[model samples]
Target: MLSEASNFWGLFKSGSKEREFRKAVEQIIGEKPSNPLLYQLAFRHTSASKETNIGGFRESNERLEYLGDSVLGMIVAEYLFKKYPFKDEGFLTEIRSRIVNRESLNQVARKIGLEKLIQFDGQRIAHNRTSMYGDAMEALIGAIYLDKGFRFTRSFILKKLIANYFDLDAVIQTNTNYKSILLSWAQQEGKKIVFEIVQENGKHHHKEFVAQVKVNGEAISTGGGWNKKKAEQEAARRACESLEIKSTQ
Candidate 1:
């Protein structure tokens, strides 16, 4: 935790470029970062990474993104669990996915001004920016978690990101319905689609179902869930991604 006076003096002493980045981050997150280096690492894209240590190890936001992904999922899961106490596991899972999906993260990241701070090879990723902003968003979460710990990070997510950007009613009402979309696409393309329960684990209420979607007798994708329908829907969603089929929603 940097004192306000120290933070201002530190910024005053830093290089012009460093001061700019620090100020930008402070504006985005609504606080002075205790450790600015973490934020710097968080915005570093792999495209602009350089080998920094032993063997082919490079410094980039990937590791932070991985950590942030888990943290984000847990936070969202807990939020959904409490917000919709009457909802089942499937409902919670689906809603969580909708909230943290790549597209949603990307949109949120851009909306929060991360796109300007992310250090990426623009020419290299000019056509592949879909996941870039989203990845940096996760990394930023990880950095926040490290710097401020879970409680503060959670508050920031719920208050700053979720409260400002997400509409719970809208998210709940919107249906991508990947299964229906995949089926319709299969019918139009004359491809036979079959969803089969490949595996079931555990017993009773805790059991998990794995569904595999096969097209023309070959497996296209597989998904797992607490129920058969949800598992098949996940498989359909993956298959749609593989087939480049856009959702109607």
Candidate 2:
């Protein structure tokens, strides 16, 4: 029952579950769904997927996900532009990114009760399925656009999704970009900030890097990751914690 059309529609002769799904869709979008197939595909994860023609595999809503990502970004950008007409580009960009980021979208999807609707492989990927939720959220946006057109999609996004899920004030007050926060604070306080790669190893596809963050030439903290940037970010995060730097980006 992993988002197959038949499974969704023909699950019960009574159509009780079908009615529930219909109600759920209406609740989520504030309108009746015109195209059920698109909604089905939006909830279909790659793990329990059907093969496509041309010898290709699209087990997930990845294509739709990509489309949704673009659509969501554009809508958010427009909202930000109109809402904060006087704010600078950096502030708008950061806030827009925060709204459309994976974690935020995942939370939004969960808030809208997409977890029960989304179909995925049972056990595998469940441990770290936050990205899956986020991806499905984007795919739903793509579905809305395709089924209802841009204007309706925009209304759903701005009036329903963003208005209900996204918190503008919290995002403006909080700073999740640890590296940027650390760098900016260091510059303000006249502290010399430097990042150095302490170690690098592993094969081409699975290389690992260890990085250290230094403040005033003293080792603040060290962290490791699959790439230098990731390692540096982790190191910066550790440094922020160690130095008690208030994350106000």
Candidate 3:
């Protein structure tokens, strides 16, 4: 365990870490952090624990990340629900998926300088994989919740993350299974549609499937997913959107 004195000195060393952390938090929340420790843990990567040897004594931000992930989901869900009062569950779920997915979270992390503060294993950092950085970002959010609390985290998410980064209105409208809609429309128009699974491979637990959607003997779209059904749905949606746009133009 780091003694109280050591913790103080560690924070005081160059002050830059704390400063950067504060800046990031401010950028996210639109205000300075009330709790310094929360900001510190928000940037505390698991890799740093290995270096300090007090790894066991000082907890990683994983727990906080888990909490933050849940909190983030709820917040986004609620926002969507209120913003688009008329949207159905399926539409709401798709919009949430687009907003909270790996790519979206990474974009938020990068925008807030979370990437620079991450402390990860050198090898993993050098490789620059998605899972590591994505997990680290979630862990940081979790830490923020623990250190500061939900109100502040929500403030940061809404004002900085959501308002500044994402086009919530546009996402809600467009982030949908267009293939499904297109297929439905085609069938209504007395057209036949089919989705064929072309390939399936990967470990049993993590297998992926590729599917193509066809209409009237013409291939309309292709997509991949963890399962055949999902892949087909995605392809169908894409095909529908493309065909619709072409017809209108």
Residue pairs in clash, model 2: 46-59
* Winner on lDDT (2 vs 3): 2
lDDT of 3 by residue, 1-249 (tens): 432322443553477856865776676556677776655655555444433356457655566678778888888898889988998998788788888876678777777666665544443233143344556567666766766688877776777778889987676556355555765677678888877998886654346788998888888889877657667767876786677632221
Supply the global lDDT for candidate 1: 0.83
Worst 10 residues of 1 by lDDT: 1-10
Q: Write the per-residue lDDT of candidate 1 for residues 103-215, one digit (tens) a residue.
A: 78989999998876777654444414237788999999999999989998899899999999999999988867798789889888999999999999865424678999999
Clashes of 2: 1
Candidate 3: Cα lDDT at 83: 88
User: Which of candidates 1 and 2 reaches a greater TM-score?
Assistant: 2
Report lDDT (CA) for all predictions: 0.83, 0.81, 0.66
Q: What is the lDDT of candidate 3?
A: 0.66
Candidate 2 per-residue lDDT, tens place, 160-243, comes to 888887678988998787788899998899999999999997654346789999899999899887667768878998998999
Better of 1 and 3 by TM-score: 1
Best by lDDT: 1
| TM-score per candidate | 0.70, 0.77, 0.60
